[model samples]
Target: MFDKLTRTFSDVLRQVSGKSSISEKNIQDAVEEIKIALLEADVNLRVVRRFVNHTIEEARGEKVLRSVNPGQQFIKIVHDRMVNLLGSETEGLQLKGPDTLSPILFMGLQGSGKTTTCAKLALRLKKEGRKPLLVAADLVRPAAVKQLQLLGEQTGVPVFAVEGEKKPVKVVKQALSFAKKNSFNTMIVDTSGRMHLDDDLMKEIQEINSVLKPVEGLLVADAMTGQQAVEIAKEFNERVGITGVILSKFDSDTRGGAALSLKSVTKKPIKYVGVGEKIDELEQFHPDRMASRILGMGDVVSLVEKAQETIQEEEAEELQKKLQSSTFTLQDYLEQFTRIKKMGSLQSLVEMIPGMKGNIDEDALNSKEMKKEEAIILSMTLQERHNHRIIGPSRRKRIASGSGTSVFDVNRLLKKFDKMRLMMKKMTKNKKLQAQMLSQFNGNI
Candidate 1:
């Protein structure tokens, strides 16, 4: 989501990448550009200073200046330093064994998406084969408990809330007993939040934390808050200890100041990030992969992981066979759309592919166009989907009317599908051509 920062780094790299030699002045100029970019992106002033200083010190070293490929060496130094500034390594949640009860207390300010993050984490743990119970201990906010209950139902995770309980500590205690009795291995307590950090709010959270003795006290900070989120996290960590941080609304946070600055300022890792509103949109943070993304290097590992999670092995094999046989139909095309939608938005997917960042029009990949194409495909009869060649002029007009599109639109889609199928047939039959294309793709990556 660091679009501006990515562009800046990409521009600096392109300017210096092909040079046979680079001087100290060149290194300083590049680092200066990076410093301005980070500051404009709202990164912490101290963090930006440290990152710039470290990068310069490393890039100006004799080992880098005299390397066989000095320009590439300089780029590597920048990438490595950025990775280190981001955290150096991925840190996962420290949880007890599945046999033991693991209480995870969520604390944040109001409107930070803390309640939703509770449900999202529970769903993730549930998918990971943990029996998670959502405790609606947020008695302050109106409808907070009901909101958690609704989220629990959507996620298929049970919720524990005492109807008349006013004290969050009492509710949490009862929730622990209920979880133990019900064999719930993971307990996620949604604690009350305030408009701002107040004494009463801190006291309530502290009491609940003491009662729960949680294995993880995660602070759900809003990424959109930028450095303010970092300040809030630092305060939370100081007042009531937090094991890690969770940046919510990360997908919408294009500047990415909070994510880049939180770990550095708080000395706590970002265990997870809230990418979207869906229960399944939570993603574990990987510092190396994130650094790659920020530098416009792409995150192929995360892309592959998302594919593995969304696409079934059997279905993928069947699609491959159909492509090889030249039997891929409109039905298969529509199914592919559904699978990609499940994986994520098309723009997000494009950003994950190696060498594809900032290369496509964002508006062209918006959901409206995809929905229109899906409508056109769904308006077709089952036989028409299986045998698109059978749709003549009359059928085309009817399909267009049914889909609320023009006949030209239908024809254009058919033309594109035919060309794609022909390309697949050619690639399947010609191993030499396929290898050449594969080599080209690998070169770009």
Candidate 2:
């Protein structure tokens, strides 16, 4: 989501690359641009200064001078430094005591997507083969418990909630008891939030922490808040000693400032980032891949993980068989749309591919365009979705009426789907060609 930062770094690197030999003056000019970019993105001024200084010092080191491409060498130095700033190595969630049960607490401000993230984490833990219990300790708001319950239902996880309970500490203690009784291996406490930081709120969370002895206290901060987010994280860490940070809304137009500065400022690693609103959008924070994305390089590992999580194995296998037989159909088209829907917003998905952020129209990605297309497809009959040969003028009119869309809209969808299907067939014929095109597509992103 650091589109501006990526563009700035790319331009700076290009300028450095044009030089046969690097000089202090040239490096300073590039660093100046980077500094401005970081400041404009609302990065902490002190952190920006330190980062720029480190980059300059590294550029002047022997490694850059003896390198084949001094510009690329400088880029590597900057990337490595950025990774160090964002926490060089990943730190996974810690679970204490027996493997049969452990407590993990999530705390953050209101509207930080804490409940949704709690469900996401439960789904993740479930996939990892851990039996996690969802505890709704957010009694400050009436809907909090209901929201967690709905999420639990959607994820097929049990929600431990005490109706009308006003005390968070008591709610959590009871929830932990429920977890122990049910044999749930882990307890996740989704705590309440306040409009702003306060003593009572902190005291409540602290009391819950004291009772639960949580192995991990996760601060789910919204990434779109910029440098202020880092300050909030620091406050929480100072008050309650957060085990790690979780940056929600990473798919939004968040500058990488908070992510890059938080670890350095708070001395805590960002364990995970919420890339999308979907349950599968949660991903382990990888410093190296994040640095690569900020430098206009794609993150293939994250992309592959997203693909694996979103695309059903059985469906992929069937699609591969169809590709081998050159028998792709409109049904496959609908399936592709379904898969993308499960993966969350297309724009967000593209932005995670390293350099694709700024160049995309984010509004379009978050809009109802995909849903409208799906509706049009849903209006079609089974034969129509599969064969696409039986839709005559009358049928088209009926389908449009059923979908509440115009006949022109239906025609446009059919045309687009046909084109995509044709392109898929062409790509399937040549694996190397397809790989090359996909690589280029990733690079541009």
Candidate 3:
């Protein structure tokens, strides 16, 4: 998401990494480039200054200056300092035991995606084996309660809301009793928000907070708002006392100003980030991995985690068996496409691979090309999928017509599939190549 920052850091690294040794002047030059990049990205001026100063102080130390690889040493210093600026480690929600009613109060300005985040968090907690109830306590906005209700339906989490309750505190109080009676371990209350922070808004939130005695008063801020998100978090932390922050629309936050500045300004950890509009697109924030991604070093840990979450172990083992036996078919190939799509956008996944950042065509990876491939594969008959070689010219034209593509497109896909199959067959027979591939895969994990 930090595309600009990543490109700048990559450029700076390229200038320094190839050197046999680096001088203080070289470090200052690279740091200055970074400072400008951060500023352009809308990062806080104070944060940029502090980050720049700390990086220079560390880079000028004898340890980096006299190191065998000064360039690499300097890069490590930057990565470490960036991680600290982003919060040194991941911080999770502090919850009581499942037997207790752990209320999580959500607060934010209108249009910050606070209601949707409540559902997302509830779904996540449900997946983690907690009985979560989504409380639609956002009474100020006309459709907020309905929105939360619809979201709860989509997520399969129950929503607790009085039919006509106007006071958020009363709604939350009733929700607590309902949750405890129903054995719900976690209650996520979507409190009211406003266009701007007003005393009435703060008072309503504070009253609800006092009633719920929430374990986590999370402020959901729009990452696209840049520095304004940090200011909003500070205000909420001061008035309503937020325990953590959740940055919504983070996937679209290409500049990454809010995420880079939030922790430094508010001292509140970003517990979760809404990566996409889908209910399942929320991700836990990892500072070290984010730092790596920002430096164009990739985030293999997050990539592997996405794989583990979306791909079933049995399915992976079955695919391995098919590959070893040279029995992989177009059906298996299509299934693999579906699995990868579930993991995330191809561009995002590619960014997680080391050295692959900014090296992909966004249109090609995310647009009609992939959809066309899937359509062509789906147009194939079961027998054609199992035995692609059996498709003659007539069948090719028929499949292309069914898929709304030209015969040339179908042929291209078949050729690509054939090449892939041949490679897999070769790898199956080559024990040494297979071992090397397995070793690399395991090492990434």
- Candidates in order have lDDT scores of 0.89, 0.83, 0.89
TM-score, model 3 to reference: 0.96
Against the hidden reference, what TM-scores do the models get? 0.97, 0.86, 0.96
- Please provide, for model 1 over 284-339, each residue's C-alpha lDDT reduced to its tens digit, 9 standing for 90 to 100: 99988888788777788898899998788998888888998989999999988988
lDDT of 3 by residue, 1-445 (tens): 7998898998898788768888899998999999999999899999999999999999999988899989888888988999999999899999999899899999999999999999999999999999999998888899898999899899999999899777888888888889999999999999888999899999888888888889999999999999999999999999989999999999994689999999999999999999999999999999998998888888888998999987889988888788878689999999988888899888788888877787666676764788898999899999999989899999999999999999999999989988888788788779999798667644332
TM-score between candidate 2 and the true structure: 0.86
Best of the two (1, 2) by TM-score: 1
Total colliding residue pairs, candidate 3:
0
TM-score of model 1 vs. true structure: 0.97
Count of backbone clashes for each model?
0, 2, 0
Better of 1 and 3 by TM-score: 1
Off by over 4 Å in 3: 426-445
